[model samples]
Target: MVLSELAARLNCAEYKNWVKAGHCLLLLRSCLQGFVGREVLSFHRGLLAEAPGLSPSATCRGGSRCSPRARQVIKCRNEIMHSSEMKVSSTWLRDFQIKIQNFLNEFRNIPEIVAVYSRIEQLLTSDWAVHIPEEDQRDGYEGETGSYLSASQVNEVKIELLKEELEEMYLQAEEQEMLPEEISNRLEVMKEFLRNNEDLRNGLREDMQKLDSLHPPNPKRDSKEPGRETPERKD
Candidate 1:
């Protein structure tokens, strides 16, 4: 019924500029469908201003003289408008609260995320002591020691080197006055690379730690027997 009224109002040349007028009527129609519609309607009508801005009194224009049905319609319209406004306001507030809660949750997790990233960085950059064979130690060290390094460790070093190179390139590009857009694009790529590197490093560290803990390092054995004496000591 409200939709029909809106269509009629819109079709009328006199109501072309009264688009807002139809909105209030539409709200009333929706409110009337609910179980509390009658109560809501009554409350709004009682609160309605008679004759535009005047209080409901005998002296108010048509306030005391309107027919019962006309008065009911007027009251219903007022309630519909108020209820619509309240619904819009409440919906907006709920959305705003949800957004605020999400922002707070993100803020709270930032420190823990940063700490994990730091741990990842430490693990990536850590230098493990490689024990060279007795023969290899005597020869002049040429390339990287053949002593085995974990694949994760090598990848970490590569990432660190790439980061340093990227920083240098960025500085050089800035010095040469590269276009702002290009510089921004390059920075974005660098940031993405760093983020990926951190993720990879963290995952590798976790896996390695788990493996190490599962199979602990073997205890060292004494080079000499407790009851045995060295031949040189016999002299």
Candidate 2:
């Protein structure tokens, strides 16, 4: 919401079509055109060092950058993502909400964009019910689909967990200079599953690309007949 609006406000006609990218701020930084800190976005958002690039912005507290709200939020995001747990305490979430809310308010002129504040509150507060197929399959199981987290969140969580595990397997294999058969099979299965699920595929598009790079596909082998095996060449 914010990216598209920023693009509109900036009148970036040449770069209006690049939306829905997964690397949230990286994409924004590309379109920033030196608006904020240019080269040190990575460290600026890190909240570890003081830099002038992210300063004097609507979202950042310039000069006295003990803890700029934008940097704080970005730091928390990195913690959640790199921790691999993808979990944050309720207190952390409430603090995050406050910081992000302030950032969002800076662009309150965009009504459509500001409306996301309510939606974020809704998602943050909503209870996610676990679906137990064995119990749900009972003759008189009546459940309200609306009583759970949005489908996108659920699907993303599933794919993220799988991706985390698969990534670990691949990393371990790469370090050993070998790809285990089990890891190879798991990678193939994940590729197939992602191929079949468009929502999952698009949501994790960048992640999937990185994962593929870790284990490049053999198109020749894949295109061959099911019963025919490609011969390995030895020098």
Best by lDDT: 2
lDDT of 1 at 18: 19
Question: Local distance difference test, per candidate?
Answer: 0.38, 0.47
Question: Each candidate's TM vs. the true structure?
Answer: 0.20, 0.37
Q: What TM-score does structure 2 among the candidates reach?
A: 0.37
The residue-by-residue lDDT of candidate 2 on 101-192, one tens digit each, is 66556646654445454555444343323233333222112344223422344444545555555566567667855555655666676667
- What CA RMSD would candidate 1 show? 35.2
Task: Name the lDDT value of residue 53 in candidate 2.
Answer: 52
Tens-place lDDT digits, model 1, residues 1-235? 3223323322333222111222323332343345245555675566574345645443423344545444554553343222311122334333333432332244344443333333323322232222223323311122432223333343444344344334444554547666555544554454454444453344344333433343344569988889997668554
Candidate 2 least-lDDT 10 residues:
13-22
The root-mean-square deviation over C-alpha atoms between each candidate and the true structure, in angstroms, is 35.2, 15.5
User: Which is the leading candidate under TM-score?
Assistant: 2
